[model samples]
Target: MEISLEKPIQQEVSVTNTGDLSEIQRVLTELLYVPDDKLKLVVVLELLDYFKEKFSQKDYKINFFYTKQNGNITGFVVSQIDKEYRSYGMKCPTFGWLTSKDFLSCKLLMGECEDFVRKHKFRKIRGPINFPKISGGIGYQTEGFEAPMLNGVAFNEPSSKVLEYLQELGYKKDAKYSCVEVVESNWNKGNNLDDDIVLKFLHPHEIRELRSQILTLAQNSFYSVLADAPGGQSRFEEMMDSYDLVFGNRFVIKDNFDPRSISSIPEFIEAWESCDLNKIVPCCPLAYDRTNGELVGIIMALPNLFQLWSKEPLTHLNVDTVIINKEYAGRGIFSSLQNVGQITSRLHGFEYVEGTTIYANNDRAISTIFPHSTPLRTHYVVQKRILRK
Candidate 1:
């Protein structure tokens, strides 16, 4: 009788560029899906839909690449090239939605990304940064794996070995971010701001009326400090649109007081009445020039609705964005706006306040925004240097 021996399973890794979103979604869902968790899945699918919409619009250069192992989809990454980033320096494209089954797969997929970078003559590659500003996030999860995933925050399996693989593949840390939580007891009630600065909770009508001003404030406040400016009216409107769908009229305007008493504007009353505070406490607090009514600072936060989706008590408020005009930087506007939002959240029974993606080097955010708070989770944005041909 002839001796029979079974051959070992061969390792197969292949990467391809495709427009098939369904396949992309399948791979991502398989990687991220949690049983009995509909909300997280919905958010994931919605983000993919946003990518699809953007692709259809052809507004930006978005490329999708996926890797297969032994004929099974095992990894994927999306590379986005923004025209505006070129003016700042090199057209360093951002790679996001990175998911993979194993370290080998991860390395190979990133190899494909690097090849794309080389082919395009881009100077560097950065990310795991998703986009649209409103729904995207930066970096890979390096700490706090036990913490529940928040909406718009990046997620990675602690055991995936992806970060390690990146390090081995010549990626270095470009930036670090922190997610922080502040409890009611730690509320930093700010010192008195200048008399000419007026802080108030912006009503819905006021938000609509002041949309242009708010966008301007965002652009002016964030342009210098951030890599990407908030840009033109269309981008700001896109963010607002995302906020509306994500929050679902749950934003708390001023207080529990009668709507008519707070605003004479009919639209304001109707909008305020539509909010269901029992579910979540969301607010937009603003500091504006008392003299000219120009916006000086702003803070926006919404309930941690991910808690509800996880079947946990909704007791957390998430501070999404904080912007203080450069001219008014040291006027305590940042702290004051946060204090007001925290007070409002506490009054409505929230137990903790969380802020996401605070850059490690942001001295102003660290010193002024939440001085004493420690990070709940930490993330690192990685980059690779590519030599020009």
Candidate 2:
């Protein structure tokens, strides 16, 4: 299949299924700024190989388009179509996992995608998804391009002009996403928290208890968070696991007067004799009702840091979550918890603090911790019509 566009040179493009992996990879590497050693490319190749095998069964179809100049390959676009979800599937055949840096060549590739979808009787096209859902699915619409191009998410760094051209050709913004950054020093200095709420290091036993609660809270929060940000939960867990490899301690704040001291290693050991060697510290916040002596609120902090755009590691105290019963709202429990996180982060050598929030959340967090920090990135929920009918 081939298409030509009328331009200064009258470029002719050919779309084909050559089953040529190396040739495809060569053009792709040239068009995209993918680093030679990034593991994302390895994952991409694996996905492609899996697709190739599946297409052999005739359950899936693969398409490729190349812009050739005198038979030398200038660029290519690859896409796949699956027939499993006929009802909800796009009107045009959906094709994605596309990458190209060459301006005009990339445009031609997209045009070819539209042509393929039209020829196949597809109503619309959507993708770059690693594989169709009928197969072992391996992507999230929100997963790619969450970080900078250098950080290794698939399909990052497409040229803006190319995107604009696609939009002009009838694609629209389907999603918006963001990456927020907060300098530790910029965190709110107002520690005007309730005096009864106490901030303390956790004992080994206490750490274990908090860890159990954290797991529960994280799991419960995942669905609600995903309603607004589809892939945040999985990514959050992966990030936390990575952090656990670096800092094993669990930190918390409490209302108890007798806070555990870091020097009391023996006492900690006695309390958690069966604890894994990996578990070291417990840092959390606790709030108590003076009369009832009941644990009213708990907040946990774990070390989380990100490599900045400057390539410098910015260490910050990250609040995984703060749990307070609904009855405790507006009683300053949340404020106290965040204060503990801020103070503890500074003491622990962190230079920044950051967390994600959904649009529906109250803006109190922003006003309290980051009045001026720019919302570094904004995420969106994007949609496109599948072109193959």
Whole-model Cα lDDT per candidate?
A: 0.66, 0.45
- Residue 18 alpha-carbon offset, candidate 2, angstroms: 10
Per-candidate TM-scores read 0.82, 0.48
> Could you give candidate 1's per-residue lDDT for residues 1-389 as a string of tens digits?
98769786976788888767787677667665332356657666766887788679766677788888777787888887765442123446778778777888888888778777887777788887766544456778878777656655666667767788788889988788888876433333354557787766544444556777776677666655564332446444554554454443453444556756633534233434555443332357677788998888877665555665566766766676788889988867777666655655564556667788787777888876566565688888888887755
lDDT of candidate model 1 versus the reference: 0.66
Off by over 4 Å in 1: 1-3, 9-11, 33-37, 83-91, 132-136, 184-191, 227-239, 242-282, 308-314
lDDT of 1 at 87: 16
Candidate 2 per-residue lDDT, tens place, 254-278, comes to 3241313431323222323333223
For model 1, state the Cα shift of residue 277 in Å.
9.8
Query: Looking at model 2, which ten-residue stretch has the lowest summed lDDT?
Result: 132-141
